[model samples]
Target: MEQKVFAFLMFSGQADEAMKLYVSAFEDAGIVSAKYYPQSEPGAKPKVLHAIFSIKGQQVMCIDNQLSDSHPHAFTPALSLFVNCDSEAEINEVFAKLAEDGKVLMPLSPSPVSTLFGWLEDKYGVSWQLNLPAR
Candidate 1:
């Protein structure tokens, strides 16, 4: 059996906003399911304890503000999302849109392996590695 990749994100009380933004950005994005604390469970806070959303046909799970300020940071460069793109136009559109108000760690240009490639951190603080795979 082959192992699958699923992204689990922890936000500082912005999971709902992030999900809304990402869902609007991706064509087929949708919530598979979600549960709100306290409203659906007893004695819980009103934070997003667990939720799943699909992006571009891929599923990504997330949580929000579940930990205190003492919680250790878990995000890293090694865990960035890898977007497999099919065309330069599509890549440019996504890369540009995501780079708005965000830092572009790597500029979009031709590489030895890709004609369109770049690394960017979106305004929401999520990192994305965009690339147009060889046709």
Candidate 2:
């Protein structure tokens, strides 16, 4: 058996949409595999049961949580996916894309730790931290 750990995001009903957006936002990112919920019940909306995707060589899993309403907890900035960008331009571009229809926690600007850094929550409420390491 393969024992591995990865970030698993639970979405209400937007797992597939979020996966597509992520694949488009980052280079070398794509969905590896996805399984959909069986349409056993009438009027049941198809949703992602499980999915594995890669972003910049990092694997992340996502699912459409059936119990999302029961679990009121949500993704928070306290635990954000941090991306270390190679260039200021890359960081800026990524920040712009992520900020679309989203709330910016921190504007992309020069910081003491990095030449450029920003924090934002995507439309799906997933928090991200984009940073360009200080030279």
Candidate 3:
């Protein structure tokens, strides 16, 4: 038997926003399901409890982490969502959208392995690698 695996992202009450951005940015993408936290106290803001969304058919799970400021863990560039673009135009468009208000680790340019390749961390601190594979 084979086990299914998917990327899970923890957000500081930004999971909903991130999911909306991702689904809008990628084609054939949408939220599959979402669960929100019930307001437990007066004037408490409801947060995303869990959400499963798909980007071009790849499913990713996200949740809001209501942790204290002293929490040591955070999203890092070490793990990234690698996108294999079908064309230069697609890569450029997606890259630009993702780079908005985000840090670009490597500018999109031709490389030995790909005609267009770049790395960036989005506003939500999620790293992504865009690449146009060799024809």
Best by TM-score: 3
User: Model 1: number of clashes?
Assistant: 0
TM-score versus the correct structure, for each prediction: 0.79, 0.87, 0.89
User: Judged by TM-score relative to the true structure, which candidate is superior, 1 or 3?
Assistant: 3
Residue 74 in model 2: lDDT: 78
In the range 84-128, model 2's lDDT, one tens digit per residue, is: 988877777778888899999999888989898899999989999
Q: What are the Cα lDDT values of the candidates? A: 0.77, 0.87, 0.88
Model 1 C-alpha lDDT per residue in residues 1-135, reported as the tens digit of each score: 332878998887677777777777655679887776666667544577789888767888888865647784545566678887777877888788878887898988888898778998887688989888755
**Where does candidate 2 stray beyond 4 Å?**
1-3, 39-46
Query: In candidate 3, what residue range of length 10 has the lowest lDDT sum?
Result: 66-75
Candidate 3, 1-135: lDDT as tens digits: 332899999888778888898888877789999999887888765578999998877889998887725573578999999989888888898899999999999999999999889999999899999999888
The residue ranges of model 3 lying beyond 4 angstroms of the native Cα positions read: 1-3, 39-46, 68-72
lDDT of 3: 0.88
Clashing pairs in 1: none
Candidate 2 least-lDDT 10 residues: 1-10
Q: After superposition, how far is residue 69 of candidate 2 from its true place, in Å?
A: 3.5
